[model samples]
Target chain A: MTTTDPSSTTPPPDRRPGGRTARTRAKVLDAVIAQLGEHGFDGLTTDTVAARAGVHRTTVYRRWGDVGGLLADVLDAAGDDDWIPPDTGSLEGDLCGLNEEIQTALTAQPPVMMALIASSFRSEPAADAQQRLWEDRYTRCGIIIDRAVKRGELPPGTNARQLLVTATAPVYHQLVLLRTPVDPELPSRAARTAALAASAGAFTEG
Target chain B: MTTTDPSSTTPPPDRRPGGRTARTRAKVLDAVIAQLGEHGFDGLTTDTVAARAGVHRTTVYRRWGDVGGLLADVLDAAGDDDWIPPDTGSLEGDLCGLNEEIQTALTAQPPVMMALIASSFRSEPAADAQQRLWEDRYTRCGIIIDRAVKRGELPPGTNARQLLVTATAPVYHQLVLLRTPVDPELPSRAARTAALAASAGAFTEG
Candidate 1:
């Protein structure tokens, strides 16, 4: 994470991906995600994470500070992955594809995504990182709306973020909030609903 | 708060609303909600709740047992309220009204609902209690779809739960998950989108 303090005279040196420091960081962050998946936020401890990553406990404390720091770094690492929204010719197809990806992640054994979401509420740093990650995702998915508009499937002024939120909210609500049993048809059905609403200008910016 | 142990032959007496036991239960539960809104789950303790309720700490521990137990009872208490869905003549109006109610609750000072939601992730008892509360609310809200169907606004065999989830998910997603600045227009817009989709048969039973 970049230091936010403007008073710092000397900048921290950048560690290349192959460097020992970078490798250690990766190991620790990977362990954090795995640990969070296995044990929800309450069970996550720096000592356990350090043990899992084969790092010294003192080093873990000196580096990450606490569980919140570990969680924030894990989320920041996730944002580093080069992920782009799907392009399936039609907006509904793309949305369905995106929802399927979310479903898979949220419904994974010992679901890491759901665990992280739950942890964010307890950790301000993690919550901030997640917000940034969500914004990045929203921006990337804006292309779906742009393409739909060009294809004459949606209004030119349709709010991309709103439409995308409408399209995807049902999946998150079902899996994370309600903890309901998975419905095989929800992904396509929700996608179709959003697409229909968008085509009817329900998501058009006022 | 009903005991699940079948081995216990003695049945607990039902305490009337005006009874001392009932009053103490109400006070303690109210304190839990207040403390949650003020200090969040991490700040909540049996001592603090007991002090706030003017009840003894030992009594609280003996009755509610723990934080999870207190949270569970609070949710169970909320379910006792007689809340019915809006009876607006138009489906859009009713949905919009319901959305407004959700928006108000989610956006309240200190945001008790958001605190409870976050706390549930950390407590199994609270999660189970919340599930029951959600199911009850969903069942009660089913009347919205029935009224809409009878009014010819929505098609027959429309899945009430699916439609309601689609309509309300965006508000929770934006407010709780993203923690975004309030968009005053979102509640009505989301309701409008869902209403349009339902009218188009996007939420029809498969």
Candidate 2:
């Protein structure tokens, strides 16, 4: 319907009610990821995504608005997944598990994760969406530190966000920033380092 | 001269042996940084850079080839600076100094450093040059760890690259990747965490 015009719509129904609308959104977003993975942000366009999603170009335009909107929605959809933090009994183990997942996502074939990160630099909408996703992830991972404090593996008053950032920053630095060859030991080593620092109350809040 | 044609030249003389050549290189590269800071990668162009540097378009095209080559040269020039790591007596202090420098570069008014990082994602040549620049900085900063070992602040055999990465990644991770607001304490806190972790032999090589 012409009522679906994004200019007139207040919220711009990305999650429109009804099975058909839901399916269209899912298909469009899925296509966005696939296109980003395969062609990168430079090659992505509403026309390409619409063709790949088997949807009308006008529909794609009305819904997503632009490439930035498409990229933002893809990241927003990612945060909707039920991604619970690992519970490996110890903080070190939990961090190691988390690091492994990060490593895998970063090194995935077609480099979708890295593409999204790169896209965020070019798109304001994607950057904002990514910030939300990161905040959501940080909040979710706070439980890892909570569990560790309960297990007496870490001291009370440890700042979970600080410790988590310390533990995970190395992977992103090494793999993404430096573009270094992957070191299999990096994940566990970084986790151990952060875990040790946390035990010493280095991340404890005032 | 026709001899300066990039196709005929095997080495592509970015640093030709003459005061004029040096001056031109300096002017152009400086212009590249200024343009990148002012307009970002999206707005950067060979024509705009040439105009900014007061150089002819033909000369800019002959030397730089394209935006990618221009970006690569800008990064390469950064590695030529005589940047010695801070010798702040203690490892934590040295790391704090290093982190503070990183924070400033990342949060500069025009955000030139961050723009270079964002450009690397879109340009293959820029990415390669950035990798080399990172390697050079890491190697140069190794002296900080060596002095720490000698001063008994950290254990012998502590991995300098690993320790430096641990100390510095948080700043980049927070400022660049997550786009978090600058926390003035982050530099020292991260440095202290990394120094403590190194004292515990977490980064010691096998």
Give the Å error, residue B141, model 2. Answer: 0.7
Give interface RMSD for all predictions: 0.6, 0.6
- What DockQ was computed for model 2? 0.76
Scored by lDDT, model 1 comes in at 0.90
DockQ of every model listed?
Answer: 0.74, 0.76
Evaluate residue A158 in candidate 1 and report its C-alpha lDDT on the 0 to 100 scale: 91
Once fitted onto the true fold, the runs of candidate 2 whose alpha carbons sit more than 4 angstroms away are A1-18, B1-18
Candidate 1: regions farther than 4 A off: A1-14, B1-14
Write the residue-wise lDDT of candidate 2 on A1-206 in tens digits: 32475567476455555447788998999899999999999889999999999999999999899999999999998999899988878899999999999999999998999999999899999999999998899899999998998989888888999999999999999988898999999999999999999999999876
**Candidate 1, what DockQ?**
0.74
Error of 2 at B93 (Å): 0.5
User: Best candidate per DockQ, number?
Assistant: 2
TM-scores for all candidates: the values are 0.91, 0.92
